[model samples]
Target: MRETLLLLGARRLQVPAIHVARKMGIRVVAIDPSPDAPGLALADCGYVYDLADKKQCLDIAERERVNGVMTLAADFPTPMAAFIAQQLKLPGISPRTALLSTNKRHMRAALSDANVPCPISISARSLDEAIHAMKSIGGPVIFKPAVSQGGRGITRLEPEESLNSIKSAYEHASNATRGDGILVEEFVDGPEYSVEALTWDGLTTVVAVTEKLTSGYPHYVEIGHSQPPTCSTYDVEQLSRTASSGVAALGIDWSASHSEIRLTCMGPRVMEIGARLGGGYINTHLVPLSTNVDIVGAAIEIALGRKPKIEISLKNKAAAIRFLVAKPGIIQSISGIEDVKNLTSFNDIDIFVNPGDRVLPLSDADGRLGYVICTGENSKSAIEAAETAKSLISIKTV
Candidate 1:
């Protein structure tokens, strides 16, 4: 049987990829540092290894002689995947390109050099440097880790805010860094969107554009996302074109990418790009339901050295996913999931936490315990259905 090596198999995004691979008659060798990961139970073989440990992952891949190695949703694993694929002469982005995609500073520099629309960015190795960059770039800036993902180490600073927060941001980033420093950039005021695409021979084909709604104001946690963005067709076209240009500038010939961008009054600015599927069920649920696109299968085909089958068989529909977050502490109980699941427009509901499981505040993507996906024929209806579902579910903590 053909074999595929899947890195960071602990995530929810890896689940669909593994399921799709199994249905295609491929044996999956799942690797993750967490032995108790739920996906490991379903894999044909499971190995416990740190995904960031490039040497360890590569050693296992070589020993297994896997046909292709891949990772989904996690930015840190991209470079490791690229390194292994490069060593094995398989289909993958170059290690340098993968690094650029993971590090915001490098990605912005590359995009700027290529004349692509991107936020003005500066690198800060120290607090003084960050202060200087903020002063130079003017106020209303975003301080982010050079390589952190899922908004773990991001802080948006206003002109009036003290520099004390920058130190905290720096410490948080330093705690997560291997060696790379922090990146600060001008905060673009606009609507945020995520563009999904697949590349073949350096040509990028837009898959779907998702309208992202975040917790406005102080916390920038992503509250929900929907497909077939509610923006004007012109805005959508511009976003697609800018996303394509950003991917092309990265020099990736064959791969899948999930890019986040902001549509400002000035224009569309590239936020960040990942050479993998979009996180939070964007690929598994929203894309398939709204676009009738089988992205997981296409990713597998691309990994196997074949052109991806890309086509949008459905249109004029919308799908939204809303995550349920809880206050910090242990989860006491959850109620109303069945009621929400019974709703006509609610397509699916998944709860990841048990009654006794500890829950964290909604800071980053990892803090989400579960999510509800709703669908409708229009954006308003879809958003309404999602809101209804969100209201039905109640998470209690102690």
Candidate 2:
């Protein structure tokens, strides 16, 4: 008998997982707030319900008698999905671990308790506390909602920034949080990387080391990623070890994990961790394109309590994704899309806005115009190809 798998999100990022589940002969039950979510049409059955409503999703899971529950590219659904899995005795992380992973403060505490190497962090619910936390750190720092996603409400501050700036950053984080409090932490300066891995019980197997490029300060929203970053073999090994330790510290079991690491002057320190596969199409495209490992499918297997096949079918290949951005204005025209598609290295390109549409300032990931994915013989070439693809596409705005 085919098992029913409950997907806690129906957004574009979760669509690939839905497709993978259906291909594995699993029944997909997707839930989302929007009736027109792209993944809804692909699922065997989809419910129009808020994923944050744990009781409602639990009811649906019970009604469907789902054998597994999971989510990707989202944090809101982590706790609920884990709670449902715990209630149903399905294979997944514990509800406590889910809370620890979703809330940045709790996660920092857990990592600290486990002696995992990470930056000093503090939770601040009010502006006064935030100011104090910054002073305590006594240097450059980061302010963000404890439960933020898509890089929303995250700001970096220099040590010399004024009180007004701190207050504004506090308000930004507080408003974006909606519920979770604010967190202030020492800003580690170094190259950033995300380790994509699968776990069974307490063991973690790394599949990809993704090098992250971001829009430099006040906001560090990701701009691009290259799988198997152009680093020495030792650097990759260190990143994998640090990220693996973070997964263990978070008590994540029977799931896919994406752990962000910073190679600091002292050593490799974990920045954050997720109890699901990565977002920004990293799992859906870049991972598979580079290593031939279907991470989304592996995530499904883990959700089903099966030992996922994590072996890399290919090696020495690489993939990259670069976001498209434009100056804030009304777009007049877009060019080079056809040219981008014709490129030998081109894998895919998606443009969100058209002529006469407004392109807002890039505050976070949501503000991105679109993205281009490309392949290469190695990470360097892959990144260069992605850059070339971005340059070819011109967005003229007024």
Candidate 3:
């Protein structure tokens, strides 16, 4: 009999984890508010329940007699996962660690205490407090919801910009949060990178480092990601070390972590850490192609109280994912997807809309029309393949 895992959030991101878990012979029991969540159809069994309602979800977990609880590429569910595990006396990170990982103020303080390099950030719920923070940290600050995911409620405020505008940002952040405030952080100018790692039995291993592409200024919606970045071995090691240090600092074990880092002229500074799998298909598509690690399977094992084998089955190979773009308006038509699919190294693509759908301005990742995944002998080649394939797509908007 296979051990059952209660998966939180049966959306598109969690669908990959469901597939991987089922492939590994684990029975998946998924839950989401949406009865139509895609992963729900793929799981062995599922329930329509908001992941935030721990008691309701726990009732299902108990009913299923699940061996573990976990989520993928989602934030709010991480704490809920830890809660279920702790209540059931299972192997998992503490509830405190899960909550800490999601809240920016707590996460930064922990990193700072551990001497992990991170930006100067202050939490505020009022304009007066924000002004005080600005006075201390100066301008050109970034305002982010204390708890958020997928590039939501993030803003860049310039030095000359009106400080009063932060009030509106605060209101936005407060509403977006799960009962929290906002973080005013000194902007760290650098190339952004994301580290994917798995922590088991108190040991964290960095699996892959991905170079991030984003629409800069104000809302930084991620555009693309390429693994096996063109950096020296030492720098890569440093990135891994910084990420590892952050995981250790946050006491993240028995889980996979996605750490957002910025490599400034001074050094690498951790922007924030998500105590769950990286979103945007980074783990599902990019990690497997570039590093040859089935980490989605490994994460399930961790949630199942087992140490997953983390090994490099493939070396030097690279993978990349580029998002298809379009202007904000009603899409007249879409073309060239069939043509792009024929290109070498074109692994996958998904156009999110049909002709009648309206494309919104890029406020977050959802605004992205679609994406193309590709693999190659090197990072440059893989990125080129992905971008080339993407260039074939044309989304006419009015």
Candidate 4:
């Protein structure tokens, strides 16, 4: 009999994972808050429920008699998946680990206790506390919500900034968190990278290192990513060690983890770890393109309490994804999309906006209008192809 898997978050980002699980002969029960979510259509059964509501999702899972539950590339769903898995005694990340991974304050404490290299951070609930944190940290610091995603409500405060600046940033962070506490930490300056891994039976395997490209400014939004970063073997090993240590520190026993690390002058310091696949098409496009690892299929198997095949089938090629961002206003038209798509080097092009749709300024990851994924003989070539495709396509907004 085919086992039923409870899949959370039926957004477009999760469609690939749902399709992969169904292809593996596993029945997928997808749930999301929106009834019209695209991925829900791919599941054997669909439910309209908030993914953050653990109790409801658990009840549904129980009624369905699901073998396991899991989520991919989402924030709220990860903890919910953990809760359901624990209730059913299934294979997944521990609920305690899920909470620690979702909250920045708790995650930092755990990492610091484990002697993991990361920024010194403190949690604050008010502007006065934030000011005190800035004074204590004694350097340029970043204000982030303890619980938020996609770089939403993240602000960097300079050393010479005034109280008003702190207050504004604090307010923004608080709003994004919906009054939840905020995390103020010393800003680590350096190149940032994302590590993808899968943990099975308490053992973590570092799958790939992704070089992250962000628009450097007041708000850091990921603009592009290339797999198998051009780094020395020693650096890769160091990053892998850091990622493994972080997973161990967070107590992620059986699940996929996305760890973000910054290579600073002092050394490599972990920024944050998401208890799911790395978003931005890294798992669906880049990781497999660079490492030949079937992360989605493996995740499905892991959720079903099966040991996944972890062999690297190909490591000679590379892949990259470049996001398309538009200026603030209404999208008048898009041109040269077909031209860019016709390029043999490009793998896929996804446009999220259309003419007459309102477009916001590039402040967060949600501001992306579309993206282009490309593969090449090497990382450098793949990156070049991504850049060329983005340049070739023009989004005209007024």
1-398 per-residue lDDT for model 1 (tens digits): 56565545555568778888889888888887787776777888888888888788888888878777777677778888889899999887899988888887788888898899988888888888988888899868887778877777666888677757767766766565555788778889899999988887677889899999886554476878998899999999999999888898887667889989999999999988888888878888898888888887787777777787788966647999988888888888899988998988988888889888988767677777888999999878898899899988988999
Instruction: Please give the lDDT score at residue 389 for candidate 4.
Output: 95
Tens digits of per-residue lDDT for model 3, 1-398: 88999899999888998888878888999999999899888999978988889789889989999999989888978889999999998778899999889988899999999999998999988778877887789857887888888888888887666646777666656667766688889999989899999999889989999999999987888999999887778778889999999999999977999999999999999988988989998999899888899989988899999999989765657999999889999999999999888988889899888998999988778888889998888999999999899889999999
Pairs of residues clashing in candidate 2: none
lDDT of 4 by residue, 1-398 (tens): 98998899999988988888878988999999998999877889999998878678888999999998888888878888988888889889888999889988889999999999999998998888999999999999999999989989889999789878888999889988833599998999988899999999998888899999998767788999998798878888888899999999999889999999998889899989988888899998888778889898898888889999888755458888999998899989998888888888889998999999999888789999999988898889999999999998888989
Instruction: Kindly list the per-residue Cα lDDT of model 2 for residues 73-100, writing each as its tens digit.
Output: 6787999889999999999999999988
TM-score, per-candidate, Cα-based: 0.95, 0.98, 0.97, 0.98
For candidate 3, give the lDDT of residue 87. Answer: 93
- Give candidates' CA RMSD values in order: 1.8, 1.1, 1.3, 1.2
Stretches of model 1 off by over 4 angstroms after superposition: 1-8, 356-358
Looking at candidate 4, the ten consecutive residues that score lowest on lDDT are: 309-318
In model 3, state the lDDT of residue 361.
87
lDDT of 1 at 343: 89
Tell me the lDDT of model 4 at 202.
94
What is each predicted model's overall lDDT from 0 to 1? 0.82, 0.90, 0.88, 0.89
Task: Judge candidate 1 against the unseen true structure and give its global Cα lDDT, from 0 to 1.
Answer: 0.82
Query: Ten residues in a row with the worst lDDT in model 2?
Result: 308-317
Ranking 1 against 3 by TM-score, winner: 3
Ranking of all candidate structures by their lDDT, best first: 2, 4, 3, 1
Provide the clashing-pair count of each candidate structure.
0, 0, 0, 0
Q: Which stretches of candidate 3 lie over 4 Å from their true place?
A: 163-168, 314-316
